[model samples]
Structures are given as structure tokens and as C-alpha cells.
Target: MPPKSKADGAKKARVPAKRKLAEEFPPGEVLTDNAKKKWKLGSAVGQGGFGLLYLDSSGSVGADAPYVIKVEPSDNGPLFSELKFYMRAAKPSLIGAWMNSRKIDYLGVPKYWGSGFHEKGGKRYRFMVMDRFGVDLQKKFEENGKKFPRKLVLQLGLRLLNILEYIHDHEYVHADIKASNLLLSYTNPNQVYLVDYGLAYRYSPEGVPKEYKEDPKRCHDGTIEFTSIDAHKGVAPSRRGDLEIMGYCMIQWLCGRLPWEDKLQDPLYVRDSKLRCRDNIDELLKSCFPSENLPEEMKKFMQEVKALEYTDKPNYAKLRGILLQGLKTIGATDDRKLDFGVSANDTGPPSIKVRATFSRTLKRRGRTLLASHNAVCIWKVPPGSWPMPAEGYLPTAVIVCNYRANLFNSAGSGW
Candidate 1:
């Protein structure tokens, strides 16, 4: 065999290094943006894959700081990707103009306040400033035992439609839309915001849309359980794909699980399952809500999503109408109130199977269930009380409780 050429070596180059975690910045540390605006950092409250989220404010940073700063290494890719979308489409004035033109009370999109590079300890970091948010929908979903009430689901669908249409019109598609990425307003829990634009794609450039094409290397490029068929096929994210993903989210939120969730490790299997669900929406509903009457509006919503083509624009008003009709059918109005309390709806909480691992761990710990609701248990633990799980006893289930998470230690004890 001939020796490999230099080009072959280049083609086989190593993948890029994972982004470095950001170091903590002390409270009162100040950073300036490109606009010459200074933001003071409060305590670090959260962290993401490549960065730390610090409470921030123009005045003295405090416990009630209304803004957050997401800081990552200057050379990292995720922050840069998100910055592009924010700089282009998430400016406050632009979002305000859209909401005014549409006559909507509010939009779910987060406004981009400011962003710039910061240097500390001889390291450069990239950061963006935005409004602080309350707990994410995923946490709320779990607290409610993985199922949102039917009315709440419809309300969420309507809000997401509004958000999707706004981003789509701005030429971007958020490839990943899951409960974890939808966050409530810090001051108003009723208002939700669609966040984490790291995977946002500019489907169209300067009013020109991209043609449909797929690459094997890009296959299964999003959250496997809820990703769209286009994402499974490696096609670039588009408006229809976002809607399709939203459909999946609504189904999961209402039904507690998707048919293919048990096999999420197999992306191709998951893809084929979604494809089959798209072809036969009834079967999908039946599998999800086995004993219950199928939600007619959900069926209609999925059917509408199925009809969309790769390059076609989505009928946002039609989708919103479907959800609005669903609200009407249930005798609920779009009051814009998001209730996260335990649901007492006719559809009882979906059956939950406690994993064998969790059961075994509980048995080993000699713990008895104190109370149970919707398959989640509640317990009381003293403050700062928690114990390390024995090796090889990983559990997948989370307990539903009313207490705030930070009240306990790092690992949850009382649940």
C-alpha cells in the first residue's frame, strides 16, 4: 500500500478539545462590554457545559440581581455560536418592535443586553449579559411528576408557537427545544423564556433560505428523544423542524414519555420511531395515552407538522389556532397564567415504574417511603444532610417535593 499523504493526515486530524470550565469570579468583580457598559458580578448561581452563570447588576450586585452573565473561555465555540444569534435577532428594541407590531402582550425570547470579552488571571473569557430566570420547566415538570396538565400543555404550545414564529422570521431555528431549555421569568413565574441558543442555526441568510441536503456525519444532531426527522437525517435545522420538535415536547409533557424514550441510546431506532409516528399519528397517541380518549387538538397539531416540507414556511397562526381551540374545548381561557402545582386533571398522572436500581438502593439504605404521589416519594432531611450513594448504585428517578433544592446539601437527601 502507498504511504498516506499529508492531506490524509490532515483529514484524520484530532477533534477540537472540549471547552474549559470557567473559573469563579468574586462578588463585586466588574466587567465591561463593548458598549462601555459596566456590569458587577454577584455570587455564582449556576453553571452550564462550558461556562458559569453569575448574578449581575448595574448597581451593586445583590441577592435580588435581575441580570445574569454567562462567562466562558474566549476561544470556545458554544458562546460564539449563541452570540451570533443574540446579536442578530435578540436585541431588546427588535423584540419590542415585533411584539408591538403583533399586538402581543409579551414575547418569550430573552433580550440580549450586552456582551464582550473579559480578562482575569491571565485568561480571556467571553461573556453575555441577559435577564435572570427562575427555575426551568424541566424542574417544574419533574416536580409535577413529569406530566403537565392538559390546559397547561396547550398554553405552553401557544407560547412556544409564538416564540418559534419570532425566531423563524428572524432566520434562526432553535434545534433543541426541551423542558430544560424553557425557563420562567425570575420575577414572574408565569412568563417563560426560550433560552440556550448554542445550537441555533441561521437557516436563511439575508432573506435567502438554504436548500435541503443531508450529511451522514451530522445525523442525530440533537436531543435524541425529541429531535425532528430532519435532524435525524442530518438536514440543517429549519422552521418545520423546530415545530416538529415542539410537537414532540408537547406530547412528552402531556403523556410523561415518548414511545421511543426507553431506547434513546439507539438514535436510529428513535429516528425510525419518530418517522413512524409522523406517518401514523393515531398510533403514536394510542401508544402514549393507552386508555384515554385521544386529544383531538394534539392529533391535529401533529398532522399539521407532518405536512410541512423542508423549505416551506410554517403556518404559525394555524398552529396557534389549533392550541387555542384546544384551550376552548377544555373550557379554559388563555389567561397566560402558568400553574406548576400538582395537577388534579381528569387524566391521572401517567404510570411510573420505579427503576430496580433505585429500589435496590432504597432497600439497602433501609429507607421506607414516607409519602407517595404520582409515583414520587417525599421525605424529610435535616439541613445539610446527605450521604454518598454506594458505588454501582446509580438511580435514574427524581423525587417530587415542595422544598427548594438549595435548602439541602449537594446531593438531595429529603425528597
Candidate 2:
């Protein structure tokens, strides 16, 4: 895409438009010259349950950045559910947006640019323009032979955790959070974005806490494998439900197969298949728990997760830390450097000063592009090592040394 012009950036920075009925037209609908004048349509990208996505050609020219134009046939009910959810949920200050933009870098959730309607062959179609996220997590997993590197898996886990935390915080639930819905930045693999809010909903609309409410026909709203057990029962989802689904996704990524894949062909067999994989599920949970080998803060977070009772599980902060730590642990390599220096001066009396600097680097795969420096100071030395100087004599000495050390400790020997 061309560099974001001042106008484009300002437009991007604006809060997404609220849902409006006028914007929701039936198929065979045509945009006014004003709306048509704003965007130039390009080729189709892909389609989802709600609409077809196309590349935008209008706006500042020469900007290769593509915007997805989502077109829904007019006969379908007003395409406002997803748009409503997107508008309510797309604020950068919101926890979900922050975690998504910073931690996961999942850019699947594109920004809303503009919307319009068109008519072709007597049918009305409504479309909205959004940023086009390139590849998805599913393709990446397949490219890695079904099982992603542990580090990448952990990074994915953390990103999902952040997304869940943000979603739950807003009293909403991402009814759908799966690999296909998870988008990646075009320029970076570590960046993962969540897209397609069509299925998202307020967690506790009407003051009713979200609980799983099963509907066999809609059982597939979210991907079958990544969905939580309660979701199959048709209960409104709880925050844990989202986390549980995320947990399943992580295990699937690590194992190269979904827990219920064998039974996936027959809906009746899915629950049993998941039960059969209980041991694997427990192991996955344990893998994410905190330990001495992991970052201390992360371990503390695992402790928090362990402490949570079924009804008392809304600790977004702890969960976020745990997921981040797990992500860091995957393909974690630590580099530490220690520097020591000494200075002395003498005249009538003598004095000396000593200083040390320590630094560490933690590396992980998959989310390396999203990495940021986190540092802590361990110790400090006081100054007072030299005597006072005399008018006729003066002496000084200085020593400096620096060394590097590897501090990373992992549960497994390799990824």
C-alpha cells in the first residue's frame, strides 16, 4: 500500500463508524455517485459467510496496500451484526486491540475503510472496505508440517490469550476464534490478526452471563476443533470457554492433529474424541504452567491459573503473562553480558569507583518480529575507593571488562 497520507492515517485513526441502517442495503443495491466516487474496486480476494472480499484500487494511487471489499448479496439479512460488533470492539485503547496490535501482531482483523452497495443483473449487493490481511495461521501451520515449532506455538498461545482477555474484558466473546479467522501481517509472520467478527457477540447481553447454549446447526459457527465443549451444548460462552478453545487450538498446533480429528467426519464422535485426548490436554496445560526454568513472573501466573475455580476464572492479566512467557519459552535463547569497570585517583589521598552493567536477550521463533526489550537491574555498587589528591602528585587507574553468557533454560532440549 502507498505510504499512509496524512488524510489516510487520520482516517485510520478515526473510531470505526457506528452501525447505521442506511449503510445496510439489500442485494442489487447500487452506491450513489458520491460513494462510488470514493473507492475504485479491484480483483476479488476471498469470501466468508457474510460477504466476498475484494482489493480496493481507489484512494491515493500507487499505494500497493490492498483493502478488502466485503460484498454480501442483498437477499441476505442486513449485514450489520458483524459491522456492529466490529465498531464496538475496534478501539486501540481497548485491551483486546492493544494485545492484538502489540503481542500477537495478528492483523487478520482489518481496519474499516468505507462501505457501499452495487447492483449487477437485477441483484442487490452490499460491500464494506477493510484492510486485507495476507496469509493465515492455518497455511503457516501446514507449511510447517502440521506441527509448528514450540516457540511459535507458545507465541500463538499468548496472542490468543491476549485476544481472549480483551474480549472478555469488554463483556463480549469472540464466538469464533480459529486459524482461518486469524490473519497474519503481510510483511511479518510473527504478526497474527483476528478477523471476521460476524459471529462475535456481547458476552452477557441483557445481564445474562455468557454461557454455552448449543445449537446443532450452528455448532460450526467457530471451527469444530477449536471450539470449547460447552459451545456444543448451546450455552452462552464464558471467558473460560474462549480460553479452553484457545487451549485446544494450541494443542492441535503442537500435536499436528486436532484432538477430535478422527471423529470430525461424524459430529457425534467429536466429543468422545476430545475425551480420549484428555491426557494430552492435561499435558498441554502443564506445559504452560510456570516453573523455575520459566520466567518467575510467568510461573506466578501459572500458579494463578491453577488457583482459578470454574466460576472464578477471569484473571486476564495473569493469563496474558503466562501466555507471553510460554511464547517466549518456545525457541527461547538467552544472551547475557556483564561489564565491570574500576577507577582510582590519588593526590594527598586516594579514591576509587566501580561499576557494572548487565544485559540479557531472550529469543523465540514465530513471534520474533513482535519482540521487544524487557530489562531489570540486579545490583549496584557504591563509590568510595580513592584518597584525596596533593598539589604536586596525581595518580589514576581504570579497568574495564565485559563478557557474554547464555542464561536460557528450557524444559525440552530442543524445539
Candidate 3:
């Protein structure tokens, strides 16, 4: 795909162009004039090392349109690093799994559109397009007066745990898991979507596969308050570290602040504080644990968290139940109105688009083969076309697809 040029705009007006199917395309990809004219960007939502996030109003509204656009400054190093992570690891590690597994309707992950670059003022900017949500968990907590109900916090923890479990099963770690990174889908308030996989990594036996690891001294990733103790100590991250940070975030969500928030001023301070806190771990745990007024399930959950040893932490599913119970209690009394603006009325077969970018050798097989190393494959499904199965899993027909050509034309071919 060629980068969108001014001439492409003229071509789109004459006929519906195939390349114009997406309002935006990545750098080197082309967009038709019709798409360029139709796609309108809304308010800037947030910004990070990756780029800026904007509310997008392009294509059709509701199920047919994309709701958010992430704009990356063309030549920014941090933004490029973030984009590379998304392009190579983040999208495929998580979104690819959901799409491949036919779990598009899963409640806690973002539905990604394609990514693209836009040139303005003679400078190129990279951006990723994804489904926009109503608000982030941090915003929701603030709206509730900066104090989330204990039950709701527990529910959020459970949902996040399930998402983590899924990611871990696929051999990846969401290194930057925090409240701000979690978004609530407008269609379902209870449904949480995990965004910003910029720091995500796939775990290798030799540890993070070399290519993804950044220098601990020069490159620090993750929020100060939510980062794990080991991470703060510049240790190579493991699944345990991810869960530990999650545990801390859960405490912050329920209590409105973390135990070390007042004591730590920076990552170094946080590291030292963790050592001191660990020396008196019982006292610190007591301060962070929920009060007696907390729900029974939540109280049990907190106890479990306190008892979590590096060698014997509980599995995510067990913790998930406790969190879900807590959230249900809080949601029952939640005064926020549920918004179901995006209706699933359209009746059509799910549109599946599979695109592959390969960097290694390809082997020929009679009619099937697995995705090779260093390969990026994308499969997109329009909403309302494929409903999640009653059992919560998508059908094989919906999940299986090929790395090349129409991968789904035949069934039972695993990637």
C-alpha cells in the first residue's frame, strides 16, 4: 500500500476504491479520497510515548464505524518504539489470539482496526485506530469521587485477572498494566478493555527473547505507583512480577491510594521503600488490606493477596472469582446509567480480512501450514456479524484463518 497522497483523494471520488475500505492506513499504505473526506477526528483523549489518542468518527456510526484514532508524531523515537511494539508484538500476541480463537466479543480487550501514518506540515505521524470506549477506569473512579466501591474494585480485579490469564496463556506479559490502561466499552459498562500494549512482551525460556528487552538503567517502562517491586528494582520481568503489580493496582483501586504512595517519590525511592516494607511486610499488608466493612469475598481476596508468596501465588482464575463477586456488589448499587447506543442490528456474515507480513523463509505445503517466526497476521471481524457462543467461546469457523490468502475457506486447519 502506498502512503495516502493528494492524488488518491481524486481517485476515490470517481469510484469506490478497494484500498479506501479503511478510512486510514499505515505508512506506505494508501487511502482513497472518499475515506479521507469521510473520516473526521474528534477531541484528543490522551497521549503517551506512542502518540495521541483521538475520538474518530469515520465510516458509519455504531457497528460499522471506528470510534478512536491514536495519532503518533511521525518521527518521534518513543512513539516509533511504541508503534513497533504494537505492530510486531502487542497486536498479534493479544488481538491475534482473540481473533484466531473466535473470541471477538470478549469483554476485556480492545477491538483493533488497522494502523496508519498521516503526513502534515511535511512531517509524518504514525497512528493506530481502535474501538473507543466510554471512559478509563481511572476516570470512572474519579467520577465516583475518587473512591471506588470495594465491590466494584474487586470486580475490576477479577476481569483484569481473566485478561491477564489469557495473555499469559499465549506466552505474553502485559508489562504495563494499570488503571489508566483499562477502558470500559460504551456498549457494556461492565466490560473492561485492556489497551496500550506498548510495553507488552512475549516470555521466552531465555527471558523476553532479547529483541524486546530494553536497558533497565536507560529505559524504564510502567507507571510509578503501579509497577511491581521487582520491576522497580530493575529486575527482568516475569509473570509473577506482572501479577504483583496487578495486586498493587487492585489495592489502589479499592483504597483510592497505594500503601507506598506517600513514601515513594520516584522509581528508586519505590525500590527502597519496597525493601523496607518487605522487612515489615505484615504491618504494611495490614494497612493495605480492606477494612472489616469490605464484602466477605473481597476480604478473602485481600487475605489471599497478602498471603501471596513469590513461589506460591494463586492462579488467576481463583482470584478472578473473588474480584467478580466484589464488582457485582458495587455494580448493583452503581448509579451510573448504562448506555447501549451501539446496537447489533445489522444482519450479515462476519467480514474477515487477513493480511500477512512475513520476514523469514516460507515453506510450501499441499494446502496448509503454520504461521512462521517473525510473521504478522491480522484478522478483522465487523461487529454484530459473529455472536459469541453461549459457552463464551467463538466457534472454530470464526476463530481459524490462514496466514495467506483466504485462510478460513477451509476448516480445522490450525495456525
Clashes of each: 0, 47, 10
Kindly provide the TM-score of model 2 when superposed on the true structure, using C-alpha atoms: 0.59
- Candidate that scores best on TM-score: 1
Stretch of 10 with least lDDT, candidate 2: 338-347
Which residues of candidate 3, in runs, are more than 4 Å off?
A: 1-50, 57-65, 88-105, 205-221, 266-268, 276-281, 289-314, 321-415
Residue lDDT tens for model 1, 295-399: 788899999988988889989999889988988886778888986654333244233324222222122244443232333332332223234245543333334
Model 2 lDDT on a 0 to 1 scale: 0.49
Best candidate, lDDT-wise?
1
Report, for every candidate in turn, its global Cα lDDT versus the true structure: 0.79, 0.49, 0.51
TM-score each candidate.
0.80, 0.59, 0.58
Candidate 3 residue 291 C-alpha distance from true site, Å: 5.9
Ranking by lDDT: 1, 3, 2
Against the true structure, candidate 1 reaches a TM-score of: 0.80
